[model samples]
Target: MRVFATLLRRDLAMLLPGGRRGQSLLPFLFFLAIAMLYPFAVGPDADLLRRTGGGVIWVAALLASILPLDRLVAPDIEQGVFDQLAIRGIADEAAIAIRVLAHWLSFAPLLMVAALPASVLLNLDGSTLSIVVLGLLAGTPGLAAIGVTIAALTAGLRGGTALAGLLLVPLATPILIFGAGSLARPDDGGILLAAAISLVALAIAPFAGGAAIRAARDS
Candidate 1:
């Protein structure tokens, strides 16, 4: 229990904005940049902006989400943190699960909050804004898990950041579809589906990341 707490705290500190390595503003800024520039590029069509805004937000969120993956696992591995954790009898699975939680905490809430301003910028109405927020809440955890897993797998490779981003895009596509799709639909089914996918990703990430870390260690 103590070990888990310690690790979780450390991970949060490292990944949270203004922490040692957290690119908290970078992703947030990138997300805002997309939103800010979008209206200019497409011209002032209020109806068009409202209609397509949710999807644009989803795209921005997805791209911004990947920006931090490069630092996810590689830094810890380089600093021998994982090796030390293993030596102390901590399971890699447990470590990774904690990281997933930390990773999600670091950005998910901010992304949700950022959505409010984005909604204003994009001219999204109340109901559509609600759908966007709900969808992001349901999907961001899955995105975080995928980021961690990809980061772990590509920790020591050259161009690993680019590879991780490329790998993440495909895996995150379903979440994007379901999450953003809900904005266009009348029901909550898409959000439910996105939540289900998030649960699956959350369930699988620890094992997948653990295995990748083990492989990296052995190689």
Candidate 2:
């Protein structure tokens, strides 16, 4: 437990905004930029923006999640951080699980809060805004899992960063669908489904990332 806490703190220090590696802000800013700019791109159509805003926010969140992918696992692998952990009896899976939690913390909460102003910008009603915040809360964990897994898998390949971005979109579609789809019909259990999907993704990510790390270590 202490080891996990230690790792979590380390990962947060690396991944958090203005951390040593200087991440966190890109995704936050990117998410905000999308919300800020969407109105202009579509012109002053309040009704249309309100109607479509939830989905746009979902898409923006997913895309913004991608911005930090390359930094998630690659830096550790490169610096032999995982190797040091291995020496101390930490399994790659356990390490990855910690990272997944840290990764979610890096940006999800801020985006949820940002969704407030975004809601106002898009003219979202109270109900829709509530649903959007709820969906993001339920779904961003899955996005975080997907991001870390991709980062681990593509850790050493050439052009891995771009590939990571490309791979995330398709893999994250289920979360996006159910999460954003909830806005259309909030009481239809879409949030529950999104949460379930996130749980599944979260379950899979640690093992997948562990194996990918093992592979990277061998090659």
Candidate 3:
């Protein structure tokens, strides 16, 4: 537990350095801005806003989550941290878990925070807001897991951003479907199904990503 906490703190310190330019703050704010613009561009009808809020929020969350993938492994790889971890006594599985957890920590909260203003812009009610938050909580882990895999695969590649999106979007369709479906009918079984799928994805993706990272390291 202490090791995990130390690793998380260390990674956060490295990723979020204090400076005039906050590294991730801009991108996160940009995501929020974009999400807020959707309802205005569609028109000012409250019903339309309510109906579309789920899809808009889900789509924005997915995109926002994707934005951080390129940076996930790049800095560590560039700084030789990846190489050091590879040769260190720590188990590869543990290291991969740490990396994935750290990535989740950095990216998921930003997406959730961004979602708040978006919900308001879309005129989401309490139910929709709750659904959106729950879906994000359930789905973002899957996003991070898949992002971790892509980050590892493209850790050394030049056009990683495009490649990561190409690889990720297809895999992320199920999550999008479930997440949006949950919001569509928060009272129905759809939301539960979505939550179930998200939970499954959350459980499965990390193991798959960890294996992929280990294989990538070996190759």
State each candidate's clash count.
0, 0, 0
Off by over 4 Å in 2: 186-188
Model 3 has an lDDT value of 0.72
Tens-place lDDT per residue, model 3, 72-171, is 7666656766567667655545655676777677767877777787888888898788888878787777777777777767777789888987888887
Candidate 2: tens digits of C-alpha lDDT, residues 129-170: 899999999999999999999999999999999999999999
RMSD of 3: 2.7
Worst 10 residues of 3 by lDDT: 13-22
Local distance difference test, per candidate?
Answer: 0.93, 0.92, 0.72
Ranking of predictions according to TM-score: 1, 2, 3
Ordering by lDDT: 1, 2, 3
Candidate whose TM-score is highest? 1
TM-score of each: 0.98, 0.98, 0.85
Cα lDDT for residue 182, model 3?
76
Q: Give the TM-score of candidate 3.
A: 0.85
